[model samples]
Target chain A: MTEFTLRSNLDAMYTVFLARVRILSRYRGWFLMDIILPIFLAAMPILLGRAVAGTSMEGNFLKNVGTANYVAYMVIGANLFMVVSNSLWHFGFWLRNEMQMGTLESLYLAPVNKIIILGGVAMYTTLRSLISFFLAFTLGCFIFRVNPFQGDIGIAFLFLLVGLIPVYGLSFLYGSLVLKLKEAEALINIGQWVIGFLMGIFFPVTVFPRILRFIAEIFPPTWMNNGVRSALLGLNYFLGEWYLDLAVLWAFCIIMPLAGYYVFISIEKSIKKNEGVGKF
Target chain B: MFEDVESFYAMCKKQLIYMARYPINFITSFAIVFIIILMVILATTLFIGKEETNYSFNAIAIYGMILFMFLSDTLWTIGYNIRWEQVQGTLEALYLTPASKFASLISRVTISIVWTGLNCIAAVIFVYYVFGALPFKNLIFSTIVLILTLSGTFGFGFCFAAFTLYLKESANLAANVLQFVFMILCAMFFPFSVLPDSVLKISKLIPLSYGVDLFRSSLMGYPEGFPELLPVNQEFLIILLFGIITPALGYLLYRKAEKKVRTDGSLGMY
Candidate 1:
């Protein structure tokens, strides 16, 4: 395996990124629908809260979830879900689609590292997720009549930036799963929902039992979510301090990508030897 | 007609075999219901009185879920069945059949509805068992409401299926988006009252609105969450009126769309 120059790798990343942008621009309708999805997801729990609690949401929410800004709480959770969900689906499903389209073998023939090409997709996923996240966040606030720019905005941005790395790592992990398993739709669908459930997209981890809470806390997105909510809505952090949660996300950032890359590489070599990666 | 029955039954058997082929798909669908139910139970329990969130309440939640599931499946099968056909390279062959497209659609929709019905029954039983007693207060009336709900959904499904064929390549996205769009606008979980006034007004216009309301009211004896916007009789009248018009409208619209797609020569493009 010859090591490519850094500039060439960067160019490869940019090329893949540009290709994604062009293809996404072509399907203008799907792009718009994807943006609108998180808002609708957020609306479900928000409306359910309205129907259930009536005027008591502020006080009761504070009691249960540690914040009176229940609207923003759910909006943030759902948007984080959008980010995680889109990365997993887009990166993972795109690989599966490429296999079906017979582009996987061509990609393997390319001189640039597969990771660099994947870096391009990961970059594309991040751009798209961030776009959807803010659009839905601001729009949801306006619709729900909450102040969107309250709390520590800078910390929330920092958490989002840090949290995104591990999400990218996990996307590659997901991509590898598709490469090996060859069933993208069901796996991605089920994976996204299970993430949503585990991440406590609608409720705080405080409501989860010991086992569930432990599971959620270990997952970086769960920490990222709590960090954002804690910053934005003044909710309690998982370990009672803002930096403490950020540190955990940082740890995941290192661990998840390395784990994901290792697993992905091992599986890719095996698939190449056996049925080949394009068998899916 | 006898031949039609035979064809339809054959289609039914085919759909059943196709369904059984994908255990993961069925499990995932079943899991979606469970997850949604869990979300409803957890989120509502946090805000409302425990009594309101108890077993009886679950019965109502299950009803809402079943309504959403039925409508979603009905709409999606109609919309997505085409995508499957196109993928498998059978669209051209299917269109080559002498029978009208609606014959095939009817069988598909019928099979889908049966699956959805069974799923709902399973969910209701699960909810009832876990959540305690289900108040089937007005059994005859609830039964009537369920029929009206399914009929309305079925009518909408016809239009959806035809619209999907017209959509060609974009059918899957349309179905996927509309599934949640209906979930939000149609009050599948909360009462229609929880939606903003503008959204509530729109909900009243939706076909699923009346169906969801009817299910909640008749089975759980839950009142309209927002009665000021729409009175009970007015709502029922609108439902009955739509219940009559949708199938006719759907059939006509589907036929018209079918003709247009056929003429445009886009059916085999994808």
Candidate 2:
């Protein structure tokens, strides 16, 4: 007979979150790298553009990308990409780590619902990613000599806040893949890049071909990225209005988590019915 | 010599077989490279506009990317694989064997060359089709430069493997940081002209930077300001010495680290 009270569930979630925080605290270098890598990632293209277009870089960028501030655009893209990537990697790797350590079975056998545990991990991941995003974005702007304070930052933060749910929902789907595939590192490495490409991390989605643009539009991170850039850099929103664009994210908030949960549950059931979750 | 060759062959076979088992890993690695290259290309177009077709710039980026892939592979495959072995608890068992340890270390280079080489070729063809004709010239000279560059890079990989033995778990962070450091300092995705003067001076000091500059500049037919750090002849001389010297120096450092770890009895303690 397992207890399923609200307080107990909340307590269990907090405990999992605290344990992860303590464990991550021991790897301080990883956190530092998370904050630093985005700057370098953004630098490659900024420098490349500088080398190629030289004096006309800003003008050309404005003509094409809808912003003369190429530095801020790239920086925002890179930082947001990192945030989305961290979400996927952390959630997927959490499940994979448990599977590898042979504790996933024990976890499944535990009295608490698996979603509660996942919720805790998602909370921790969200906190870490948002911190990394803000820190890295600010640090990158300073390094590139771009003013970070420009634009409707509050709305950019709003986009990030609304957009995170679908991203985590996508992570749930990714976690299911890790469970089935049992190749976390390779999959996560490739998965992040695929997501980055689809989201147009370094370029506008309009630059993609028609079909590709349609596909990119359906991805929540694409909307999130465009929304952030629109807010911060004054780029036109995908829908030409911020509220409409955010409404799409709002719709994703309802659909994606449910879809992700359904898929995850189905996969979990199939794997358990076959060889069990501990096999990995 | 024959025994060393046999050991190397066996290790290489084992690695290949292991790779073959994971078909997804193979396919995803190929796809990831293409995605990155395309992403960078499209991103560059955002700045230069869609109408511009600077094939010389394309040549610079593509050639630099090829070297970057090789260097990155050398670091991850050759260097980090040692840490992987330790984590798997096989480092000690392998160390106790009578096989030549150098053969075991060098075997990973074959995998890097074969796998990364294929990826680079596919990327070149893909870029050529999508982005128009790239400037391809001085093939024989570029080949020599590439070989020398790879030799020096493999040496750096050996040195990194040694560092892994010393750093243990933290080597992962070190490798990630070092790769980015190399990317920027070597100006792998851009020309030296884009780097600040202070960074360019530091870049000039690193031997690998010369390898990058010379390899791409020669491949792009040494257009005006192609090899930005120094004259072609001077850069080639530097690469020539680097190619010859680094492997010997790296092997010595690795041997020293191996000896120290063995003496400390921490070879298996990862």
Candidate 3:
């Protein structure tokens, strides 16, 4: 095949990105829900803390999690969980949806490199998830009467923005698995809870057992969550300094996407050798 | 009724096999609950320390989670089963069945209730073992409360099933989102008093709120939440009232809604 010019590749990616936006807009409630879901999720744990500690929770919360602002902590966790949750499920489902819609073959037949299309999806996922996270985080803060502006705003944003790269990378890895299995629901649910637990969606990773905590530290979202929480709530970071944590995420940024793309291409080629991408 | 009972049993068997086939879903459903419970435990204990996590509150949280999860599962299954059928291209065939539509709803719920029932028992044992608190003294009494809670939840589920018929593609999202609302409104993880005045007012309107209180009160070794909002006896009376009335009302509303669909010439709906 002839090498495609940069303009054609860019145009392909833009079209795919625009398609996701337009289709998502048609189901208006889904967009609204992405904003609203985290608040109630955060509320359950907040209420539990209030019930458990009563008058002493403020003092105790500060001692344990390094932030007396438990609502903001949990809200931050919940919003990040939404990001992690959506990145995995939506990316996997985007493929399954295309397969079921009879569009997978058309996608494969397109002359441009398929990574351009996946790149388009990655960009869309980033924009949508961050916007959704922002709305939900702000709403959660307002509802709980916490100061959303507390902590280092720029660094927290830095953690979040840097974190999305590896998060998207992992989603690509997950997408390939879905492509192989042709089943996404069970895997999505399993990944969601597992990551939600390990990432401390409602509590700090300090609470996890030794092994689980070690495992959690290896994941990028764990650093992302702790990084953001540490920056915003004056909480403890996994590593000693903020830059050290960012360095780990930067490592993940380098390795995960390249690794994911490699694995995905291998799976795609093997599937093509056997039957095809449209087999599902 | 006899034919419907047979149909219900067959559907239940079908669902049982489906459940058996996807034991991962079966196991993960409760595992997710266990994870949520762990999150709650970790969150609470992080603030209160392990020892001070309050035995009474733990007991209440366990049963509240039981009811919350049961109602949430039922709400999704009964609400989305038809929509699933529609997507599978079997909805029109289901409409042609001589079996009562009520059988379809109840059978779907029976399967979930069984699953939820087993999950609740497992949850209780797990929570009690972990936390060193089980109100075994209230076991028989709690069973009575559990039965009533299931019936009242069924009443609500029946009402939701009617609306689910019209929600079509939106049924899953609508149902799941509402569960998040119900999670707060029903006081599934906390007392009603913790809610602000506006939400507190909204809490009283939810039938599950009464069952949650009754279930917690009977199981927690004390009345849980705002006793003055409604007394245990009064709450039970209202929930019992809902239990009797809602399915009947739901049946009527569903019929009216179904008639409106045909009359409005919307039967061509996908």
Candidate 4:
């Protein structure tokens, strides 16, 4: 009987997931738009290097970064940023969208607990982010003319996989803020830029000031991004060892998700006790 | 004319007073913009060449960033504010008033402008004090440039708000797109010289480039260069044109949209 009940709860959440996928599918142009923007974002740096460095651009990049292929380095950064950004947008700010749609309250009305609904949202976000990630990654690689599967692909994927749980968990904490605030535009807008900055999407965190570097280290996407770059581009890891970096990410995995979940649930309860999640 | 302006001022003041009552809302709104400006300043600083760079006016990038943030937040606030008011059912009460709706809307937007401008001023002081940037000396030119930029900004804001009246659901997307486009195309991070010639030419068509150019010229100490391709004082002319054209177009659009909704009796479609 308990098994049946758990299965039914999962099934109900899946329905919500499917509905979102279907709705997004109806707006197919958005997927293409996402793929295009990252290319342009990456192009600016590549072109700037060429313009500024002139004939010595390749040598300049090779001297600073590991690879002479700055194009590939930038493309990878942009694609990973797409993943990080979409995950946050889908899982974090999507709560605001849900509230505005009045579906947030409807879900809260259900017999299932808040965590279960969050699980459904996280699952949906994960699936969508990865889809966009793969599509943008592959297409961006094609545009930039580089092998997308170069270097320790398995280890890089492992970093991403571990990194995602914490990212989703962080998004839940961000979602809690949206719930309490009842409007998310300012927070989401500010947060994404901060995430992009801390992640060092265009450059390594080593280039940051000492204090900034410390702040960057605590951010999960910074580790995820650095790990991916180190794995793929043969860039130096922060700990001077790939395994050490991976272990730190794992530590973040353990701490952030639990901390995130606790904060989220607490905020959820507070919001419910006050104006509720449907306030938007 | 004075009465129209007075009524609009009164409406704007009332809204500001109401917002002041909710201290958190006002503080958070300003803080968010301030934070965004700080991020932009940081990003722009990263790419600035320490030596052997041709551009003398690197600080103009910071100015562009502040202007971009101010315009984007102010314009975005207009739409979202109206939507929030609509959701709160205060929009109808305001609409039923004897004062003109456009004036009232403009007044509300003016409040956003004042708040966002304060944030920008704070951002400028923070950036200058922290970075020790040289003081801008061309006060009169900078003032004219700011006025023109604001006029152009208000034009775009009015049009965007008019569009929102027809499609309320698109407000968030519109806000995001507007801000993104301004940032990317207007070269808010770096100099416009970084863009390809083709992209640069296209960006010239955007009203934002004038503000960027004027600010860069005044602060960074550039003489009226680019006369052959862009024309001398073209930024002023373009802003002047948009200042006259955009609000009129936006007003017409708003009236048409309002009429359509009234006929259909479905303003609350969202």
Q: Could you give candidate 2's per-residue lDDT for residues B1-270 as a string of tens digits?
A: 999999999999989987887778888989998999999988888888667768777788889999999888888887788998998799999998999989999987797589889999999999999889987889999999999999999899999999989988778888889889999999999999989999998998999999999999988888888788899999999999999899889989999999999999999887
User: Which should have the higher DockQ, number 2 or number 4?
Assistant: 2
lDDT top scorer = 2
Q: Please write out the lDDT profile of model 1 over residues B140-217, one tens digit for every residue.
A: 877776777677777888888787776765777787788888888887777677778888888877866777777677
Candidate 2: Cα lDDT at A123:
92
Residues A41-156 of candidate 4 have per-residue lDDT tens digits of 67656654554556666665665566676777788777777777777777666688788768888878877766777777788878877877788788888866889878899988
The digit string of per-residue lDDT tens for model 3 on B20-52 reads 776567767778778777777777787685356
Q: Which ten residues in a row have the lowest lDDT in candidate 3 chain A?
A: A181-190
Q: List-wise, what DockQ does each model earn?
A: 0.59, 0.80, 0.65, 0.20
TM-score, predicted candidate 3 vs. hidden true structure: 0.94
Pick the TM-score winner.
2
Clashing pairs in model 2, backbone N/Cα/C closer than 3 A: none
DockQ: the better of candidates 2 and 3: 2
Rank candidates, DockQ, best first. Answer: 2, 3, 1, 4
What is candidate 1's lDDT per residue for A8-109, written digit by digit as tens?
Answer: 899999999999899888777767876788888888888877767789867777778877788888888888888889889889878987898889899998
Off by over 4 Å in 2: B49-51
Instruction: For candidate 2, write residues A1-280 as lDDT tens digits.
Output: 7668999999999998998899789888889989999999999999999988999999998998878998888899999999999998888888887887789999998888889998999999999998888899889988989998889999999999999999989998998898888888889999999899999889998988999999999999999999999998888998889999999999999999889988999999999999999876
Best by DockQ: 2
Give candidate 3 regions above 4 Å deviation. A1-3, A273-276, B49-51, B223-228, B262-268
